[model samples]
Structure formats: C-alpha cells, structure tokens
Target: MALLTPEDLEDLLNKLRQSNETIKASTGKGITEICEEVYGTRPASQKVAIVPITAGNGIIGNFSSSLLAITEYFGLEGYITDHPDITGYHQAVSDGADILLMADDHMFIAHNLKNGKIAANHICTGVIYSEIASRFIHAGSKDVMVIGLGRVGYAGAEHLVKKGFNVYAYDPNTEFMEKAIEELGVNAYDSADHKKFSMVFEATPNANTISEGMITDRCLISTPGIPCALPAELAENGDIDLVMEPLVIGAAAMLYSVF
Candidate 1:
C-alpha cells in the first residue's frame, strides 16, 4: 500500500464527502432492518464501546480505527476504555455491547492506473461491497486479481466473480483455492506466477507480499493490509493513479461490492 499525498488526501476527502451525501440521500430501510436482513436477526442491542488495547505493529498503515468515535452518528451507544486482558469482541460483550464494531486490521489499498479511476476509504462492517465494487467500477477495469484467501479475500473475491469481473485469485492455501473456485466460480491461480493484470486487489497485510516494483508499470493494485490495511506504498508511487481504503468504508460495503 502507498502513502497518501496532500493532493490525494484532498481527493479522498472529496470522495468521502460525496459518498456520505449519497448515503444520506439514498435510503430504502432502517438500520436495524438492514442488520436483520444480513445477520438473519437484529444484532444484539447493547451500549457499544472501545476498549484500550494497542493492536501490534503489524497494523501500521491503519490509523484511527476505533469505531467509538462514530457511534453517536450511527445512533449507537459507546465508550472507550483502556483495559488489560480485554479483547475488543469480548469487552464489547462484557459491557453489554450488543453491536461490536471492532477495529479491523484488514485495510484496502488500491493503486489506480488511470486518473479518477479508483477511490480509497476505510471499510467497516456496514457495507463492504459498496466501497470495493465502486472502486472497480470507478476504475473501469474489467480483469481483477485478488490475492490471499482468508475470510476477507474469499468474500471479496467471490463477490467480484459473482459481479462478472473476470476474477482470478492466487492463494498459498490450496484448500482455500479449491473451495473458492469450486464454490464461488472464481478462477484460482498459483501465487508464485505474479501475473500481469489491469488491476490487483491484495488482501495480505505482510509487507513482503506487496512491495515496490511487485507490479509492472501502469498496473493498478489494491492492498488489503493485515490488521489495518493501508495503501502506503501504492500511494507513494507516482504510477499509482488512485488508492482505496476499504476497512474504514465498512465490510458490508465490501461484501456488497462483489456479490
């Protein structure tokens, strides 16, 4: 993932403004109803809060990931507490937090090859597909490659395949590869090949997985940084036309992007 320049940051802020406006203008159902539709029931209701615990250094690209800051905007209750021996999930449970918006390390970083081709934001649990698919559509890329096959990779890749993006996937996990192809209709490939593509969506957070020069010139890429995926490298490279940050945007939006 690349770093964000002042200009790029401005553009991102503009896109986010637009996105938020669109979100406010368009509405088909209530939040609880939407949650029920996705979770098969209303998310347990509780006063949500953020527990203090530093996510290890693996989550560098990600900054300011606490959902507590936005709880009021979302009509939720919450508090932030630094507590030892408390996982965010369990802490939320302990505090009677029915809805736990845990900070996700998985960040979505995209390098756009074309101007105005991609957008970046943090993806949350709300709407995962909205952010990802919107980036693809915005970039106008037809062929997409997805890296890694963990929970995020699988879901994001499957969503893209279902949306007809000529999705090709590479994962070290053969088991995951087989399941993704067999069950999700994605074209799975070996990770060692490093194929050229119009666009690559990387889900691995390890810095080694996606480094400078990993992609040929003019190829756009998205980095799903581990823990907190940030497009740090992609943003620094002049060749990167645009970058998308998915974790902050919402996981549900990412889920909605493909499927």
Candidate 2:
C-alpha cells in the first residue's frame, strides 16, 4: 500500500470513529472534539513546548512540521525547540509552558525523571505499538510477525496475541525473546523466517533490519521505528506494502493519557 496521505488519515480516523463505539464512548467525542478540548481553542496563547532528542541533526525536521500542523489543525499554540537536553526541558518549564513534550529518546528521559533524577514534567509521545496492532487488525491481518522485543514491540505482540492472532516474534536480545515466548506464548522465529508471515510489525530502531530478501511477495509491513526497518527498494517496487503511521497519532495518544 502507498503511504497514507493526510486525506487518507482523515478517512481512517472517520472510519474508526464510526466503528469503534467503545472509543467513542470512552473519549466522549471524536478526534476533533478531543483536540479542541485538550489543546484548547486558542493554542497560541497556551504555549506547549516540544523537545526532540536524537543523535542526528534533522531529527526534528519533519516531526516539527507535523507538530506545527497539529497545532494549526486544532488552533493551538505550540513550537519546537532546537535544544533537546535536560537544560532545555528546565527552560521550558521555567518559562511557564503548559506541556513539555519530548519525542524519540523520551523513554530514557522519562525513566530518569520519574526516579527523581531529572527535574522536568515531561512524557514521551512515542508509544504507538498498541495502536499499530489495532491498525493491523483493522486492515484484516490475523497472522502477524513482530520484529524486536523491546518495550513497544513486546506490548504490540501482547495486544495481537490477546486479540487471538497467530503471533511470531524475533529479537537479537535473547532475554526479550525468551520473556515473550514464556509469558506471551508467542512463536519464536529467526529474523530470516520473516518471509513466512504476510503481515509484519517491525519496532527495531536499526535501519534496514528487514532487507529485500526477507520480504515475501505481497507482504504488509507496519513499522513505527525511526530509521525504518525495511529497505527502500522493496517498499518502492511495491513487492510489499509498507505503512509508517504518522507520529502525531502516538503523540495524541500520549496527550490523551494526560487528560
């Protein structure tokens, strides 16, 4: 499948609103309604600060634009900062910012902050695996392969298993793989065995973890990991359908947790 355009995302959100009665009831509103409430009608005056932490320079490039777009769509005030360290987080808090949002490397930062190691009211807006699993189920995928057994990948595999999918998982870390097998009862497989699955979810941060050779004909790949796991050639040639859901969805979920 081709990457989801903004219009496609709107359509998907609409479909989700109509079909997911539980979400509608729990949220008590649709995406737009919640956006207005959480972000406020005048977001410019609200002033939410965003910090992007990663090794690369262009880490905030597109993500900054996406956050700006979200603010614009909901009429909220938000901006991305060039600084991505603990100092920057303190500055944002001292400046009376409503939310100090961190992207990427947030898990590490949040962990440290929660243990009285950092002085910032910050949360990571990067937990998307559960939503990714829901997306796979919505797309009619029943058998799934999960690559990487980190926190996000393990959570995604657990959701799929609970939904009664035939889940196979892999990870370079033996401990993570063993825990998934013993606790979740997921089928353990070598990374090379990915071809056996029609639907694959990759959560590894490494680039090109799933190479051209590993992709079977007509496989569907859903990856949320930065530096994307699959090769460009396979995704470009249409041998496999690749879906990288917008990071804004994860950010929205994180925001929902706050309210």
Candidate 3:
C-alpha cells in the first residue's frame, strides 16, 4: 500500500512540527559534526565506500547514496559505510578509502572540512532548492527562515545566504541554530516567521512539514523533487511531485538531442 496520502501528508507534517520539541531537548550538534564523527576517523588520499544507503532519511542520505553510485559509475571505488555501526571507521580505512561516501548528515562533511582531512560532496535533492533560494533572495527575502537544518536544510541555507538571503534557520537542535548564526550568518529563529519572506523552500526530509496549515499560503513552497524522507502520504498524493528522475532523463535526452 502507498505510505502516504494527502491527509497523511498533513498529519506527518504536524508530527514533524511536534518532534521539534524533542529535537530541542537533545544535544545540539550541527549535521557537519554528526557526519565527521561518523566517517572522518580514517584519513587516506583515495578511498571510497559503497554500502546500504537510501533516501529513507530524506535527501541527505539518499543524495549521498546517489552520489556514491554516480562516482562508482565513473570508476571510483568507495568503502561501504552504514549508519548505526561503530565499525564503519575500521572497515572504510581497511578498504583503503581516502574519501568515505556516507550520508550527507550535518557536520559530517563540515567536520571533514575543518579537519582538512577529506572533501565532502553533497547530493542535491532538487535543483529547485538553489532555484527557490535564488528566486526568494532576488525578490528581497533578507531575513529568510530555513526549516529543518539537517543535511539538505543546512546546504540550502548556506547557498541561500551566500546569495544574500540573510538566512534565518529553524531547527530543533541548538547546535544547528548556532551553526547557522555563527558559521553561515543565518538568524536561526525557533518559530515560524512566515510573514518575513515571499518564498519558502521546504528542505525537511519528512514530507509532513508542509501540510496545509504549516506552510504559509502566500510563500512559495518548492517540493524536494528528489526523493528524501518523504511521508508515504505525500508520495501517494502526487501533489508534492518528483523531479530528480525526470530531470536526469531530460538532461540525458537533451544532451543526446544536441549531440
């Protein structure tokens, strides 16, 4: 059976909003830190990992997995790393991995950057993230509020701010909020500041974040287009939409047509 429907999507979104309290009660480490601790223990110049990863965690893991597949398609070898395992470190290093392909979780890539050990590549969930951010900024959304602050959230916020969004992020973890303000110069508000921007990009993996009531009616909510932690309801509703598959095929076809 389909995991999500329109009503289910709304319910899931509500649940996500509620989960914020729990997230707030926990340790506030940014996604970059989480990723660093996960796969940055080993240091090599030309290593890779390929293991079980999917879009289940939303765009971060899904995109990372996709990136791993793409790199491998180009003839690169990677260590197969999985979350919820303490031994991924040993396995990756043993496989001679210089660059570990893991989930695009927070602080995982950022930590690698700070350590100056390895380069982290992010798999984008949708081209729309950059597109929406760009559009909103061009329309003068200076005090932009980015929700989620997870892998995709952080990436979107960073890109948006770089383009002069004056990004303000909303996440349950204090760690994420701090990173937004300190590292990215985003305001990091805790609540929904709907009136501030004419456009809003929903980067949360959970499809439930943009139910009828959660999102402002006036703000433009660009769907992930790419698969992520999408609620089954949203997936089934067909309203949220999917873009990655079509975009990929379209790009390939266009290239072939041009060639």
lDDT of 1 by residue, 93-161 (tens): 555643333332334322122222222234222124322432432244566767777765776686566
For all candidates in order, the CA lDDT equals 0.46, 0.55, 0.42
Q: Give per-residue CA lDDT, model 2, range 1-259, as digits (tens).
A: 1222344344433334343343333223444444445334323344556666664332544554565555444455777775766766777777766655664433422112222222111222222343343343224456678887876688778767876877888898999989999999998876555446656778866778776555456666766676667777666764455555445444554443443
Model 3: per-residue lDDT, tens digit, 86-146? Answer: 3665566565554444432232231122234433322243222433333422244355556
TM-score for predicted model 3 compared with the true structure = 0.41
User: lDDT, candidate 3, residue 210?
Assistant: 42
Candidate 3 overall Cα lDDT vs. reference?
Answer: 0.42
RMSD of each: 11.0, 8.8, 13.4
**How accurate locally is residue 11 in candidate 3, as Cα lDDT from 0 to 100?**
35
Regions of candidate 3 where Cα sits further than 4 Å from its true position: 1-128, 136-140, 190-196, 211-216, 223-259
| Residue pairs in clash, model 2 | 43-76, 43-77, 44-77
Task: Give the candidates in order of TM-score, highest first.
Answer: 2, 1, 3
After best superposition, candidate 2 residue 40: deviation in angstroms?
18
**Whole-structure CA lDDT of model 2:** 0.55
On TM-score, the candidate that comes out on top is 2
Ranking by lDDT: 2, 1, 3
TM-score-best of 2 and 3:
2
